[model samples]
Target: MSTTISRLLVANRGEIAARIIRTCRTLGIETVAVYSDADRDAAFVQLADVSVAIGGEAPADSYLRSDVIVAAATQAGADAVHPGYGFLSENAEFAQSVIDAGLVFVGPRPQTIAAMGSKIEAKRLMADAGVPVLPSAELDGLDDAAVQAAIDGVGYPAMIKASAGGGGRGMRIVSDPSDVLEAVAGARREADAAFGDGTLFAERYVAPSRYVEVQIFGDHDGNVVHFHERECSLQRRHQKVIEEAPSPSLDPTTRTALHEAAVRAGSALGYVNAGTVEFLLAPAVGAGSPEFFFLEVNTRLQVEHPVTEAILGVDLVALQLAVASGGALPDQAAIGAPRGHAIEARLYAEDPAAGFRPSIGELRSFAIGGPAHAAVRVDSGLAGGGVVSRHYDPMVAKVIAHAGSRDGAARQLAGALRQATIDGLVTNRALLVRTLQHPEFLDGRADSAFFERNDPAALGAPLVDGPDVAWYAAAAALAVQAYRRSTDRHTAGVSSGFRTVPTGPQRIALVDPAGHEHRVSYRF
Candidate 1:
């Protein structure tokens, strides 16, 4: 294959940028990085072969600004641009600009992007391709009168979604007819804020549905293949919190049909590189199998890519680069079915008890490597010394545990999370651990609406007596005090002067995000 580009400019920040850079380096491609003022000292910037400052911290002024990104690429003298998800990854105009500037976009054509970028338009396209989709209503006109007319056609309990937006930023659900206007307005505001497009669409809010998505890869020659499905049913606020490969709910027949549906959807757009075909799966009714419908196509590598990679034993990021360089996808016949079971839990720097709000703080201490009992794999963006910032998504890492069976996978994931420790910035690790242990989840009875109905505090922090993880900090603090006392008496530091902190007869006060403190004493 002839190479059109040797240097690639990554037009995003944080972990995704770092991910792309790693692949580019392995392929002998020089890389350039862009960062904002807030991320001037970011790890990605320092690691890149070349780095450029874009603008201020907020995504709008920096990463999302097309001009800044393109200018950075040009100034960095890169021949290709890779939009590493979240910022400009799915923006058709951004893709067009890269092509117009004579730089390889490392993705699909601009027209293809424009086609699938809209939720309503994409649904229509998929439906034409014989892919089932949920009920939809396009906001043909933005006026109140037109919305009312559209709602009457789509029916009640519909979601108002931003056609060009993602990450659950511009969406609202109206269970009652009276709240349609408020939903439309709020959705538009969020859409405009997030994607600079206020065009909204309506789709039926399917109840008891699971978020099942298939990873897809296509080349310029029109060849397409499915990388199987990942169950992203576990979500919070429409954002996926946990994902697993080879959906346990799908049988062989359903899996084949689902994969075929995803391939057809990808073929419709002439998609290239890696993208995900999100579908909504409704529960079985009466005697029939469950019905699945195309939801939306994520036009970039997903945050949950690790789960897919873990089960398939392939590096998707590397594959993406290969596709961009005009290389053929790994032979469809060469790829086997997913091996074993894989589960992923996103570790977010947020307080689960306080409504799972975003948190920002410097990490004081951290440890993630386990004893290899569960085939644990951690794809993280932070080292122990990094800071969790408010300027980006709160997800710090994705911990995946692979095993021979679903039950083993679940238990292994829980074990990995339990053994993991982070000192600074409250996280949802405990909640994820609890969800892994949740009866409904373990039995595969949970769906996309599971978190919406369950209490947030209950998922990560179960009511059961958890191993006092925080107790270690207090014991260590007290142990240090004891060691100092010994040193004070001896007037010298010695190995014998240190005493291991015991869990017996220790008490400490722990504070919740709400400023409520509880005294937790320990007894050994």
Candidate 2:
């Protein structure tokens, strides 16, 4: 039952929407972009062959409105819908709605999504499929005593997680028995607010572990293959900050075992399309092999898919479209081995000095400098004169670098980030550059707690400081004075900065990215 998608609708925004459009253009598929009020003039909207206004700025009124999105697709004459990564990508009901509307849903079967959507149920299914999983207990509708008992069963230092969602929401780690009830109540409220489902579960917490995941793809013809693994240990609050392929931490045996486990997990679910099987690898003690436990499965393409694509020389979104159209999986041998090392750093609009608070404003100037080569790539949704609204995720771009070795990739990525010119909003670019060059990160020992062990203030400190700041401020003041003089018609003959009566030196104040104020005084 193969059907061609002549016109496809992208049900997402930002860099991902732009990324999908690139693939569609190469494949000669016409694209329809759905936008909110905030994204009416976005890059993706301008790139699409057709555009539709869905709703307001908020996600509830826009991207998450499944009915509205499906109707937009129908109205735009789109035959397929690609839900990029976030919002309703993993929502089974949304997938069903796309299917019911007689449009292709470029993802897994609705049953598979429903089965793996719940952490509790997914863990049970994985355990049944012989994949290693941590001990966990369901806490929905349980009394305080029962909740405590469940926590005791899962052991101390348990994590209370929202069963219905991911992205670090509705998650709280409790080490003390006294905090169990409060943690549960708070997690429930947060989960209800975020996902409309307060169902929760508790799992044993593992510290000093590596966060690794396997990229798997399946087709309708009952075949599943892995694109190796990615190390995502560099994180903040469980959100991935930097990701690299062919984890430097794993030996051959562990790596093979992880890939096999991932394939088995996907096969068990009869999965179709692109998905990731995440795992936590515990540190080995003495001569024993390190043990890996299944985390959760993401039912859509990951944000870090570029790193995988870089190393494998493949297009995951293209493959996703092919599989969605009833195509068969490529031969396992044809997929081949990873060619080189690739690392991706997420560039976000946040003030690292202010505890990573989201920054919003017009992007007065935004440019990421690097050779437009396959070795170094930047996927972004914004440019000069664009607005970073407060209604959406603050990720501005993903900068990726590929080289023959890990050190080479890291150095290249760091250099590219250093050359980027981003103004008008605070970002984590400094922190990303510092982390890429950090000794522990370079040696591949940095874990999920890398930020906890290192001082972010020190890492995120501006590269320019001390006497150098004063020199730059002086230059800027001079440039401003020159510009004003050149533009002022009445002062053309005043000889610039001239005063009939001598007075104090002219003063100008400027603020640096770190919020430090510099006062420059000069006289002509």
Please give each candidate's TM-score.
0.89, 0.96
How does model 1 score by TM-score?
0.89
Over the stretch 423-517, how does candidate 2's per-residue lDDT look in tens digits? 77888899999999999999888987899999877788887677888898899889778878789988687776787766867888888776678
lDDT of each: 0.82, 0.91
Model 2, residue 110: distance off in Å is 1.1
Model 1, residue 239: displacement in angstroms? 0.4
Please give the lDDT score at residue 408 for candidate 2: 94
Cα displacement (Å) at residue 185, model 2: 1.2
Q: Clashing residue pairs, candidate 1? A: 430-460, 431-460, 504-524
Error of 1 at 153 (Å): 2.8
The TM-score obtained by model 2 is: 0.96
